[model samples]
Target: MSVQDYTSRLSDPASRKMGTFSYLPEMTKDQIRKQVEWVVKHGWNPAIEHTEPQFAMSNYWYMWKLPMFGEIDVDAIIAELDACHAANPGNHVRFVGYNNFTQSQGANMVVYRGIPV
Candidate 1:
């Protein structure tokens, strides 16, 4: 599916937004495939991983999914995420899976991750 179609699926109100951070809210499997069609799509910066909410979808239950993105400007990405947060309230972004306290054998953290548009 195209980005527009993929977005439509994510916005499906009946699907119940769980408000956990992972990939883009509107991202789809096909969208990911297309997004990666070009050779070596870059993340610019690494993704901010986060855990799924307690009541999230089955796919998010126990697995840690890393979202990839294409080339994008950092400022633009941040601004977009901020806008998403404003529109979606608290579901648009989050941070998790990292341990800042200890640098020894620490688990990753989750946060609002961005992918190239």
Candidate 2:
């Protein structure tokens, strides 16, 4: 059987399998907003985190701030995401939804692509 080398393809940032939305095309602002809305609708707390591209696969990530507890404003959540990205322009920024009842993460996705480390 002929084997194929997929290493090169995987080197691309878009090709790296990191999070829920990584396999899909980059999401637009509207799509991000919709996701945030969904999270809120489900009573999940929205949070932002960032990490260097090299550590994208690692379980540990630097939280932008404490999980935005009781925050229902979509715009506020998006603003925080923007702020996180702005502060860490060279780091991979991600958005997550925390389900307090289940005491676990519900949704996790990379929202910003950072420069390769």
TM-score of each: 0.28, 0.86
Give the best candidate by TM-score: 2
What is the per-residue lDDT of model 1 for residues 1-117, given as tens digits with 9 covering 90 to 100?
655332324345343443422334655534433332321223232233233333233444332235224424444333443454455442324322222234221222223332212
lDDT of 1 at 52: 32
Across 1-117, the per-residue lDDT of candidate 2 in tens digits comes to 997544434457545667558766889999999999999999999999999987777569999989999899999999999999999999999999999899899999999988775
lDDT of 2: 0.88
Query: Best lDDT goes to which candidate?
Result: 2
Mark the 10 consecutive residues where model 1 has the least summed lDDT.
103-112
Q: After aligning candidate 2 to the native by TM-score, how far in Å is the CA of 59 from where it should be?
A: 5.3
